[model samples]
Target: MTDPTPPRPGSRAGRKASGAARRRTASTGARIREEGAPRVRLPRRLAPRKSPTQDRARETVEAILEAAVDLFSSRGYARTSTNHIARRAGVSVGSLYQYFPNKDAVLTALLARHLAAVESAIHACIPPLRDPAVPLRDGIRRLLELLREVHEADPRLSRAIEQQVGQMPVVPEGLAGYKRDHVATLAEILSTRPDVRPGNHALMAVLLAAVTETVSVVLVHAAPARFGRDEMLDEAVEALCRFVERPPGRLS
Candidate 1:
């Protein structure tokens, strides 16, 4: 008997059969790996799979982000799933994947949004700070007020973002870069102020950024009752000013 005619290289039936085989192989391999190894969930696919420039796409992304924030803040990261996020956002899972590769990427996007908002506020406050006439203490208090507004805006969401920082690689880098920019700006401003003697302005800037961020997060996230908002702000302003405003030759 003649052998059955071979399926053409580009035949639809052949392609379908090949795809089925691949799916089975992938399924088996995934099962074996799942059974053989412990799952380590680091923040992979930290970038979006697709960036939505259209207004409709942007709205979808916003909905997804808001849903993620609510779920992450209420349920915690470990418990929230991409499927849940898609459902909450009222988008299909396929639509969710069109923008984000996974839940971690969603979290990354949310953190990025938060960072942008905070940085915008800080930048807007800088022109006033840069005025040589503005008292250093006044500039600092204004800065402290701006930061408090950001941190206290959604304390639960801020805490949720902090909890995922170590696991997600991009968060720390983003935050560090933000602090570095602020430090450089603060140092330049200090350099122009005759009333201030920021000994090693670079070092003082770093310390000031660190102290302010830590104090703001702690006061807004965990210790609002333990420490009053104004009280914490006053203490932070005092500490930062003391570090930057040395008595001309205090270091010497």
Candidate 2:
């Protein structure tokens, strides 16, 4: 019999078989991840998986957050005791305390959750906008639209924030990085014009977020008939755009 020899690398059957093998490997890996199975070492494909216990932990955390929104937003953080949150969540006070130290801690977590959701919406809305005159305008409009939607969807919480502006929860840990990066992005958008370096962009970004937030809070309180959401958004975006475009030494 002739010696069995390896097929050439370019053989069609070999290529087909290789492709089929890769598909099978990917399917198996996806299944393993879904089932939370222990990772199997393989040169072709490997991935980390979230185990069963991880799912339960996630549920518990989310339940606490929901309870928090109800308690803090409805009753205010100071009045919403740990026991109240526990009962609302259908979990033991001990369990509730395990995730949070005090009412402040719970509020902190809630703020983080709220900030994360807002950031996600902003991420979807702002990006790759190039024009200095119109980019900020469009970006601010999108941001305010998202804010109005979020605020209207939960008007009670929004009112709570409005009524207790001074007591608004302190910005959470690790949030500074997000705020910083976000500011940098805004600055970059504003800096496309002459005489502005990328290095100075961050300051502009910070100013943008701060000014927009202040304007948004004001807009939420004004009469809807006159300064309706869209009108308010337009005014705010226009003001911001003009501020960014102001000629040097034009402002007193």
State which candidate has the highest lDDT.
1
Worst 10 residues of 1 by lDDT: 29-38
Q: Clashes in model 1: which pairs?
A: none
TM-score (C-alpha) between model 2 and the true structure = 0.60
Candidate 1 residue lDDT tens string, 5-72: 23323221232242353111222222221111112232445766876655556656767787788789
Cα lDDT of all candidates, in order? Answer: 0.68, 0.56
User: Which TM-score value belongs to model 1?
Assistant: 0.70
In every candidate, how many clashes are there?
0, 0
Candidate 1's clash total is 0
- Name the regions of candidate 2 deviating beyond 4 angstroms: 1-60, 131-135, 155-172, 193-203, 246-252
lDDT per residue as tens, model 2, 1-252: 332222223221222232353111222222223221112231111111222234444445556656667766877867767776665654556766655655556555554445556576667766634544444456667777776666665666655644543464443335435767777776766677542333456676787788876776666666767766777788887777666654445554
RMSD of each: 15.6, 18.7
